[model samples]
Target: MKDRFVANQNAHLEMVLQQMTERLLQATSRLMARQGRPPQCNYEKKQNVWSLATSRRHCVE
Candidate 1:
């Protein structure tokens, strides 16, 4: 019947919309991460010596 066909079409449309929403969320997350600030790299300078630290303890000294 025509009603059944219409219902099927609506179900398909709903599925497509759900998929698009998921993709949009994933893309937004990726874009936000890329545009966000880079991780801090601690560097210390002591008497002509330059040291780079990537961990917490190493950065302390």
Candidate 2:
């Protein structure tokens, strides 16, 4: 029973992380657009799932 509970908890955590990552990406894209720049997003994998690695914008003057 404990093993099953742990598995369920992990799955739930992964789903929540994925949703948060998606929202972050959208907001980052919008912000970059407003600033006339583009976002360079990177994804990293953790425990067989991809998560938001970094959000960066390049500024050219």
Best by lDDT: 2
C-alpha lDDT of all candidate models, in order: 0.51, 0.60
Query: What count of clashes does model 2 give?
Result: 0
In the predicted model 2, the residue pairs found to clash are: none
* Candidate achieving the largest TM-score: 2
TM-score of model 1 (CA atoms): 0.57
lDDT of 2 by residue, 1-61 (tens): 9998986896687679778876777787788889998666533333224422321111211
Give the total clashing residue pairs for model 1. 0
Ten consecutive residues with minimal summed lDDT in candidate 2?
52-61
lDDT of 1 by residue, 1-61 (tens): 9998986896687568656755665566566669894423311122113212223434463
| Model 1 / residue 23 / CA error / Å | 0.3
Q: Tell me the lDDT of model 2 at 5.
A: 100
